[model samples]
Target: MQALFILSVWTSLVALGCLAPFVLALAYVWVDLFRPHDVAPALGQLFPFSLTTAVLTLGAYVLVDRRDPPRLGLLTALLIIWAGWITLTTTWALYPTAAWAKWDWAFKTILFSTLLPFFFRSRIQIEAALLVILCCIASNVVCFAIKSVLASGGYGRPLGLIQINAGWGGEGSTLGTYAFACLPLVAFLQRHSIVAPSRGWLRWVYFAAPVIAVIGAFGTFARAALVACVVWAALLWWRSRHKFMVAIMLVAGAAAVVPLMGDAWKARISTSFAPRQDESANTRLLVWEWTIGLANQYPAGAGFNGYLGNRFVTQDEWGEDNVQEGRAFHSIYFEVLGEHGWVGLAIFLATFAVFFLNMRSVRRAARARPELEWIGDLARALSHGVLIFMAGAAFVGIAFYPLHYYLLALAVSTSAALHRATLSSADRAPQESLADLAVGHNAARLPAWRQRAGQTKASI
Candidate 1:
């Protein structure tokens, strides 16, 4: 894998030169998520992929792009504020050493999040990023499936039993959360490709992506993922123009898979309703309650990565499960509350609030432009994915996850680009073909305004 990373780096530099750093940065983002460590161990540890790529991308953007600097959106501003607040709170953190380390990791995540909008200038660039991330996810899914097959039918259990990492690769619930968040993007791309026509191979790959993603989510055996996937699928089906066909496909897919699911999967899902019987559910509830207690006690905040160690000492007095190592904040809301206190939590929520609002504006702007119909579709898909993250994060510890912020950055860029497109088109309306541009007619027609205006005056 190290050799592959080396080859990839060399190839990018040779083929793309100035643009290579930014491309590698985006590649790093995807590779980091997939974490193909088994295939490439050195790639996992040797390179600081995201940070290095981000610095290189920033340099390239400044020197070569020659365009206006990317505008920082409301979400980005809030994130900056939130990061600063987290850093400030680290000074008084219960565990200062751990706090600083946690702060560094988080700073890196926010750094790349801030850079993405600047890098993604056009609709094609945005689509490329989405496709790349989806393909990375698909690769992870395929790997998990391969692992499960080799392990001889353990797909019904927590994936961690076979693959014991965390984040995208390890934790079943985390992987499930990722799959759920990405399902909308895959579906949107697939639908758009079919309607507008794209490369045949690319369209087929998009078409199969959602299915592979669904399989990946199911393999996780994560209840939150299951719920989120079901909700995401419904939203996609409703938003799709071919509702009946989508419905039939969905039903047929379910029919083929249902009989194959074992009792273990059924039992695992059933635990969602009967939480009393589920040890994991009980532990999660205990963790959430402990987090709430911690928030109330330490109104200022526990600081970054101050949970487990502090919990060990404080849990005996305040927690229900005094002996158990309290899991890190399971819910994003609770996570923020516990780690950052009221002010941090408020900023965190506000960031997403502004992000969703921006997406709405993007969709509205796209609705106004016939040439940018895909922008409207993408905006909706992004919104749905955001909703899924918000919902799924109730069960997953994704308060600091890069994917959510990455999507927010894209939303910011999409809205900004669409706004610019609308303004530019309006500015050019007097010279462009007015009738063809109006009422959602063909956008390819050239301007005939001068001749038409002259003929109209003559007729009058």
Candidate 2:
């Protein structure tokens, strides 16, 4: 009990540190949830990520590898060396101001790198990571719900209630981007859980939480978020055709009552796209065209920072300071082209191509390899999340965002680790018994989800 409490507290605090709007700002959850968590050692504190932990894990890995070394091959070497190049290239981006503008990316990267590796080291670590993510989602939802009700005319103004946490990341709606990303995984796990059938409150929470979240996301008045929700719903439908149909009917029924909200909802929705007709759209179009023209002018492009610092000068468009830092091409593809030219754009696309292909392959591998099943599921979900976000948001920013790169690294490392463990297990399996402890765990866990999943009423 003490240990569990300590662990809960530890995780709750970490969850708050990495994610805002989490319930940690409240005190009672500490006593109620994290008693065992309280005593648990800091995950970062132990498990060797500091200069100290790195040296120790390295030493331990070397010792273990010496005895049971998995053969390293050309592909492994290339991937590691490539990641090193990426890290070096990313570090070479010397403009502190530019990096600062995208600090959200940096923090996300740091979070992924600092925490994700623990999953590969142990099943406990994998479960812990998932738990933290889920808890963070649940906690934040509860907190934001309470605060929104208070700020509005009670819950009466559900459509009007919005969280404006400027400190976390983006203001209003952009802050909800991460939550939108997490919804699919939450939906998936909730539907499959053994408790799905038995837990009445959870059933309601699961059914309503994502809907409420989407509404809350809509309330942020962020068109980007609305677009994200649509895209994810599409993907979820693609994942299950039957559920897609059910979703369509439900959404259609909800649509029938939209007139009741009066013109306010319609006005807000219309206002989001209205920007497409105004100076903002013109500005974006101008930047995109100018950036592309500059790319054609310079073979190596205008140089990485030139997009912000010199694109205007190089293209001879500057008379006054229009932008604060002179950053150009808000779009990632255009940014790459403007800064690094066609070659840079090529490299960037190739990198994403590699990440995408690797993600697909890993997802395939996860199902094929018993040892890798859990990690595979996680990788697939994360990969899908990344795909969903990048598809909708690639226009907004570049890959300098640390979370994206950090997840790629985590994916690569864990993929290698999973492959190694699976091969080893397979080699020894024929000589001994075909299964072990984890097989049972997987069996116990899989059916619960499968059974619930079987009952799913597919809809779009």
Candidate 3:
């Protein structure tokens, strides 16, 4: 029954995409984030949902939605270069089989990201994309948040929609990271949403979504989530117009929530401050050390899944030595460094830096226009979300995850939209001014002509 329902919904979305090509883009995002195939086993076996949507979306873009293509900017160029570099590195991967498997998805993610701006060219299209992403994220985290309240969450516990701890939705740390990172977008929707009517029930849903997301983050029992929350809060306060009030609210909210934290949650978060005390934290340190050593041996990177060959030793609290092998690189920086080498890592970092600058430029340009204030707000929200993700990614290996790439694509789309809107406005301003001047000139002559007529009649 669930499978049938999901298939029906997917079919309906595809039907809508036939009329509006951009709907295909949103449908693609929905498939990526929700992973409905994973939710329903029958659906998974029947066909590849993500692949189907990707093909449909690309086809629509080429056949119908090619009217206004986005400008090929520096950010897109960097991503293309980055993608090419990673593909080259795959030839020398320590684990060729594993590398190829990862490359299959990672390359697609980069390619899709670059093309996203082309599909979403307008403000409404961009906002709709954001809303879909937010809702998909919420669908996973909101459930986890409810479970956390009913049953106090523990580290390594399966608390999300899925019972596995693998992908973004299944993994505790990654899920929590995404939950907090998405908070800013939630706030953006509440204030500037055009898709959802700004009146009654939907407004309340927007108001409660962030609170639920925070709870879901706590439910993961991930120290990374806690750190991300603090970083996001600080960034939020810094960006707020009423800084003092925001600070006060933050403090009051923390005070209210702190008492509800379970002992397991408290214990897990405290370990973040003292890494040496926790086994997981200690393992991350060992993995990072191994990655650095690998980078020294292969400065150009060993390719994707290079960490598969990692071998290291760690000393326990009791002074016992334990050997670890094939441990994952927990940090995004190290993940790229180990897999792609230093050069790849440099390219990856450069891509991120360029993205941040793009968002900054958009915000600055949009803020000056009263009508485009929503664009400025969207840019701010995206930047904040990216920052939060970066903070959390310090301890998680999601370098190739769909979430960050999607955010980058949204940023690009936003920058492009601002550029187009600004140009359109600039083109109209001169014509409008000239029209106003002509009207004033006609009005000024009308009274003088009427007086001349009256004097002619008096002379007669």
Q: List TM-score per model, in order.
A: 0.83, 0.60, 0.94
lDDT of 1 by residue, 255-287 (tens): 886556567777778889977556667677767
Cα miss at 383, model 3 (Å)?
A: 0.6
Shift in Å, residue 291, candidate 2: 2.9
Candidate 3 clash pair list = 301-340, 301-341
How does residue 337 of candidate 3 score in lDDT?
A: 96
Number of the predicted model whose TM-score against the real structure is largest: 3
Model 3 weakest 10-residue run by lDDT: 154-163
Clash tally for model 2: 36
How would you encode candidate 3's per-residue C-alpha lDDT over 316-365 as one tens digit per residue? 77989888889999989999999999999999999889988888888888
**How much lDDT does candidate 2 score?**
0.49
CA shift at 136, candidate 2, in angstroms? 4.5
How should the candidates be ordered by lDDT, best one leading? 3, 1, 2
Global Cα lDDT for candidate 1 = 0.70
